[model samples]
Target chain A: MHKLYMGNRQKAPGQQFITPSSHSVQFYEDPEVFLEQLAGFAGAAVGAGGCYLVLATAEHRCSLQQRLARRAIDLRMAAAGNRFIALDAREVLTTFMVEGWPNRERFFASLEPQLLRARSARLRPDAPLSAFGEMVALLWEDGHREAAVHLEQLWNELLGRHSFSLLCAYPIACFAHDSRDDLFARVCREHTEVMPTEGYTALQSDAERLRLVSTLQQEAAVVRAVVEERERAIAQRRHAEEKLWRSEEFVRRIIESGVDCVMILDPQGRLEYISPSGQQALEISNLSNFLGRSWVEFWKDEDRPRVEAALAAARAGGIGSFQGDCSTPQGTRKFWDERITPVRGNDGQVEQLIAVARDLTELRQAQQIAVQAEKLAAAGRMAATIAHEINNPLEAVTNFIYLARTTPDMPEEAARHLEVADRELTRVAQIAQKTLGFYRDTSKDKWLHVRELVEDVLLIYERKMRNKQITAEVSVDPELRIYFKQGELRQVLSNLLVNAIDACASGGRIWLRAHASTDWSEGGEDGVRFTIADNGAGMSPEVQKRIFVPFFTTKANVGTGIGLWVSKSLLEQHGGSLRFRSRQGSPSGTVMSFFVPGNANLQVHELPRSA
Target chain B: MAFLSRLLAARAPAREAFPSFSDGPPVSAVRRPHVLVVDDETLIADSVAAILNRNGYDAVARYSGLAAIEYLEKKRPDIVVTDVMLPDLDGVHVALTVRKVLPQTRVVLFSGHVSTTQLLELNSAAANSFELLSKPVHPAQLLKALQPAD
Candidate 1:
């Protein structure tokens, strides 16, 4: 049978006797049994006149005192004689621990003197010293397994240096929930001896001791199973924490890198969190510059009411939106479209609002530009319709003038006044046409004899001329054909002829003549030149010089102020020119002449005059 | 040349009549031939009527077909001169109405739009029922068309 390694030796000094110099660990299920075992080991050493030190939990200390007194061992006397020492394991741990780990310097500095004195005290000359510590077990029970093992190694060193027998104990219930093979093996290797709580004491029979040892071994197997389950649970928790951290990191990156501002506001509309991009979008250096401020204050004064209303809606757990201009820290005003959504708490009450503000300044400007362009296009369209509408009134006015002129036996001055009025009224038609499209007149061009066009103008003014008994004569060959925009040149000719007729006095004569001219000094090209000569009035040099200027009209209420200027422009466009010669005297007359250049591009290349 | 002399000879009385058509002194009580002028434009209709009045025709101006129909209820005129595009029931319909009611009321359809005149001409049957004149028709052309071929 194996002898129990109890620390109750009586080895005499200077004798060749073997002493217990190994440490032990005891596992106990019942507190009473642990106390009894502790008392048995320490009390036996004291009875043999040896010293035994005990560092244990307070409950164990009190239980040991009771059991020791029950066994008739006088603790007070043993303490007085320095044969036994008891300490609270937690208090001693603080004295040796430095920043949650047992420090060698602190442990030695605090307890080395006491340990030396305990070893040196020889209550009996032949006695041996022993101690039982529960500090390592206290650390292991609190989940500081590594620290507990380190402390066990420290205890083994102390035992080696002090020649004392060492014993340690942990509650069996602690290891039942956690059994680590590596930790158990490391602790056992650090100690010189390890044993069950009951194995350290002298029991009656070998069979009884074997049964208790077998029971301890069965408890160890159950502890190993628990430790395996604990390891699996720890690994899963680690993996889940890593995944959660990665997801949080991904969300942070998205918000930080976005161009828009993302913010969170409390239910009361106070700003809470501003994303990294939010500060950049706002052009603020720190998020604190915006956080804790009323969210509505971010908007301009005119838009504050809208922001406040949106916040109120969001607070009620509803979605809300606002768009308006606000000045940014960059010193520019920008339009932002903000969408706010309520975030609910677990109890389904609105806890916060999530706001995403997108900068829409450029988009709004582009839309405004597009609207202006559309308005301009619409105005262009309206001009054409307006021209058509104005023509109706113009036609009526022209008819009214015709009626007034045909009223017959009118006075000479009245007849002359009506002629100027008729000339100016034609200017209104030109303006209406130009407003619709300046190019509208040139759309239809045709070749016509100058004499035919002159006759047509004569027919138009026949009633006006005859009302004043004015004589008009046309002298042109039937072959004076001109390639031109028939309507535009006709208008030009009509304007000149009307001016000529307006210049003629009552019973005055006006002549309309056309001939082909080749005057090289006058930009001579082979083109038809038409002349209109009136024998009534002639302008002075000053009047002639400014006549081509726009809005220069001699007849105040009657002149169009644009007729001569428009006529000159039309003549220039057709590679033609309007030249005049006038003399102010008796039989004074002004002869206005227009030359149409020989046709180049203007000559129609189509099949001519299909018979 | 003969049409010119005939129109001038017919209009010789207006040359001697006075200062203006509207402000002229009162003339003989022999009520000349009555004419009705219909145009959406008030000025055009009234001015045309005044012109006819000066030319010895007693003319009335109506701005719409309804007004012309009302005027026709009291008297059937020698002619009905209506703008082709009136505010209510354009000239063709007005001409049809006038002809249906007063078979002797000669209808003249005048329009400033060439397309309207052409469209009317395309309907040869409808064209034959009325005399067509394009605006701005001179008072002489209107008087000549109204003349009994002298």
Candidate 2:
């Protein structure tokens, strides 16, 4: 039985010794030292009358042959005697490989015959048989580490059956990566003897070797600590970058979906970046055209000073805000509530400015409408008070007129004058009643003849028409009637007729037409449509578009501006509509038409009870 | 009925003899319809009463709804024409009192305030019980409204 060399030992120069049936593994860095050891092992076996079998790469085979020749071993005589056998490690690997793993049956089938021949050819039957293999190293290099380890076990199995010693060599560079300490220990555990790399093995004494190993171990510990610290710093930096990206994405999403226009400007008040919503709000399709342009250029001339002041304040690292009116790129007038704030860098210096603008056009319109409605309410109340105060005196005057007209033997001319006075007083009473109609609960609808209603409204405007020398043509069917709130309809007719009379020049003609028709636009309801047309200077297209907009008026001094808007609303309240068409030119005229439903019982209830 | 008859009989001859202003007389032989005209405006009440008197009725004038009610307490009239908006009490309240005091007497309400007239008309029971008229009422319309309903 051969004794096992579990620990590493130093050997004299050129002295080679290996016991039969020994399985040894060497992890090597330099090829020269490995080859020297290989030559010693092969030459000692051949010179001691033992057979040597070599399974190595072609390059190693050539080098081994050269080293054996220099050691004075007759490789040709050894081969002729069948005591030195050489085989390519790759070719030998395929003969026993089964799907990248060593197959025991095939391994023995291919190699046991060669082993038997080498043992029988030994000059003495008791001489040692030694085999060297590099197939496992080739497998390890090819990344088949499990196969290499399995093949090492297979070689040990072969050594148990054959009376030969096996030596396996692997390049130490293959195990240089971290976490490979277990694999290295595992490879060392598989052999009866383990040879360290040449860095340790080449030393001539144990004390020198121990000293080098102690220094290498100390340096390795320092490198391990430093690598761990660097890895931690790299991980922290990556985490911070991910958090920053998430925060940027959150802000980007908010800016993209917000309704307000948001912009970033440079210190010179030039636009640098604008949010997606900002581009849409400003009616801009391409931001490239506006980029680097002065922000104050977007405001109206009147509002430029305010915008510039706000920018200057922001540049001074303070917030500024103002409300101003401007037009968009598409030329839509807008009222904006704008604010500008400075963005500061780590050095506490103003780096950029952020401007936000909120549109307030609709809010301003609502406020104006509320004010107008309150004014109208107050006017109605004043009319009610005046009518109440005047009616009592008017009644007394009518009585006096009646008593005077019936005076005994009064002159015929004086009586006739009193009759006229009585008629005019009746008109005054009618005016008071009409004014009071605005304050009264006139929500109750009544069936009224179209002709009578038309004639009554015409009588109120008769004096104005007569003063202008304007002739009115009336064509209304006396029998045609409508169910409506009388006050609201009278107001609508009065407003339109007044507009028509105002539009007519001296001696201009006004046409008032009423016809029984079906309102196709309003679900085919039967109704009477009245058209009032005048031959006067007509409105422009821009004026026509805003004719029904509240507080939009062409008449600067006299127009209340709410007449057409209120008229339209009044018509719509009873399931009706008002529309007009106008043309400008020498034969210019305006035709304003309105429809009143024949039966508005359902709609009347929806009206407010007060007016 | 007795008080109205006494009022008409006492004022008939004196109204014809004077042809203008007449004091309250004690008694009369001929019967005439007695009318009470109430208005806060004295001219309106006096003129309306004069017109009613000229039109073959014995009429008296009061400048307030409370004064008209005070007059009604002493004597009953065939008709009471009261302005709806008055100083102390509205024509509606006076009419209600007239109905309570003299169930047989007719009540007529007139007002320049259209809203007051509307309120009376919307009061379903009052609308049925009392006749409402808009003011600046012609003397003829007022006389016609004062006429007893068929």
Candidate 3:
């Protein structure tokens, strides 16, 4: 039987059983919690059985016996331990307490065989824990005069079988059968009175036996059912959560595939999540470091305030946006379109701020190119009209000269008049020719002297500048040689001077300075810089930003607005850049700087020496 | 006293009489040579007047063909020098008008911008009494065109 029960612990088959005089039983939905309740109940049963015999007088013995008998009958009726505890009347007397002789000798004798049998019965069929616990408790209560020794041994056995020390509390389960008139109550009053000391401490052995036993079983059953249901619910919830995770991952992948940067920000303006596209657009490696960092940190310091304002406004409303240059580790990037939208919670408070920034730098550059082409087309039309209009009058004058010179018998005074007429016609023709030659490439690969270019440009403005009483100071390095179309250089210089004159208020000084740069890395020592400065009302930064844009002019009627645009285009084509410094409403005026690289290497191959 | 009497009775030179002829009646049977000087610009007309005076032709300048017709009805001109761009009508119309009103008149039409094809079409009329010339006209061209061939 011991081997069989040991086998049960290892993998015992059903059908093995034991016959016992009495048993205790419990039912539960969970095996573990029920085991705890069984241990507690068994502990009370030990104390209850021992105290019943020790305290029993003749007046209480009959009632106690009847109660024990009734309880045993109820255990059988409940079929509680029937599967693990066998029912046999003759063997029941030996196993249960047969209280007959004094000094408890007969009861001890009757229980000796059962005590030995209980030792082996501990190894009975692989019974449910409640039945096994009941068998152990009965053997403890009725086995011998040294029942206390057997109880300890039984406790050691059960504890050795179950790892949790809480199960060793089974012998303490003797408190279960305590009653006022019963012998166990008297014994509890003597030996187990240590129970009624404090709240839970008062739950010691026999004193609170009824409360402990009933509460233990009831709670165990209830907790077992609750645990099973909770586990089922948790499993179902995990399945639903996995499904949601896959869908969110799909959406994240789609967002990453797009070219536009998409990001989610929390209410604190920190980056909560950024799509892969956002990382690529912003040129960042890891999104983890970006998380919980302020979104404004990604923008330039000057742009942060505006970005924050835009975010705040968007969060307050449904939609808003801002435009600015964002400085990243990659480079300073210009973004034309940034859309911000707020995700609101049920309380109408913004929960998150979602932003999509589409790179508009390419689009803006394309638009600028198109506008430049259109402006050039319009300029071509105007040039054609002016050319046609001026040429007709010039041709008429030329033809009239031919006819006048050919007429015979013309007087000396008439010849002199014809000469004067021819001179005036020549002046008109020059104007027509100059107007037609505006910005045209007529003179190419010319090594024009810087002095000559300056002198020619100044000649156009000499009379006007003098009339305005504006002094001119020009310095050109006589030795500096530049290879370019002389006519184009003249046009660029003329336009610049004209613009400077127009921008300057009356009585303001204009400075035209040209010199070789001291820095060799910019080019050889031959690199020339032309700085044109004036004392007049300067333009604002906003004006400076759009100054090079086609058709953007401050002087409406007097300016076609193509002068600066053309100058810039020409300068860029020549591998140069134009930079200007200005402050609005200040007399400091504007200083425009132009850099021309004098590649002596170019002169070696292209320049023809006249000397 | 005899020299002053001689200066008052003697005939003025043709150049001195040129400025006064278009201002009033014809000095002789030529009917003041009611010249129709055509130009689109006002400055060119003023300049042309100075040239015409250095010569001996009686000239009246109008900026458009319509204005020339109005001036002609009041005073029939013996010649016309008109520009191609008039405010209402062109120099061709002025030429056609001069041919109709004064059949013996000569017309010199000037323009700086007309295409060769347009010029040919305008000069196609043999009875048009006109010759085409491009602008920036010299004073000699005006004198030569105005000189009567013997």
Top-TM-score structure, candidate number? 2
Top model number, DockQ: 2
Candidate 3 DockQ vs. native: 0.12
Q: Which ten residues in a row have the lowest lDDT in candidate 1 chain B?
A: B3-12
Best by lDDT: 2
**Candidate 2 Cα outliers beyond 4 Å, as residue runs:** A1-224, A285-289, A293-312, A442-459, A469-492, A505-538, A566-579, A585-588, A591-611, B1-30, B125-129
lDDT of 1 by residue, A492-560 (tens): 887898888888889888898887665475565667778889997799998989888655788889885
Cα lDDT of all candidates, in order? Answer: 0.74, 0.82, 0.57
Off by over 4 Å in 3: A1-369, A381-396, A402-421, A442-452, A455-474, A477-480, A485-491, A505-526, A535-552, A560-566, A569-574, A581-590, A601-611, B1-150
* Fnat computed for model 3: 0.29
Relative to the true structure, candidate 1 reaches a TM of: 0.37
How many angstroms is residue A381 displaced in model 1 relative to the true structure, after the best TM-score fit? 4.6
lDDT (10s digit) by residue, model 2, range A132-248: 998999998887888888888888888888767888999888877635346667777778877777766657666876787789899889988887888889999999999999999
What value does DockQ give for candidate 1?
Answer: 0.12
Each model's fraction of native contacts = 0.24, 0.71, 0.29
Task: Write down the TM-score for model 2.
Answer: 0.72
What is every candidate's C-alpha DockQ against the true complex, given to 2 decimals? 0.12, 0.38, 0.12
Tens-digit lDDT track for model 2 on B53-80?
7676788999888898899999999889
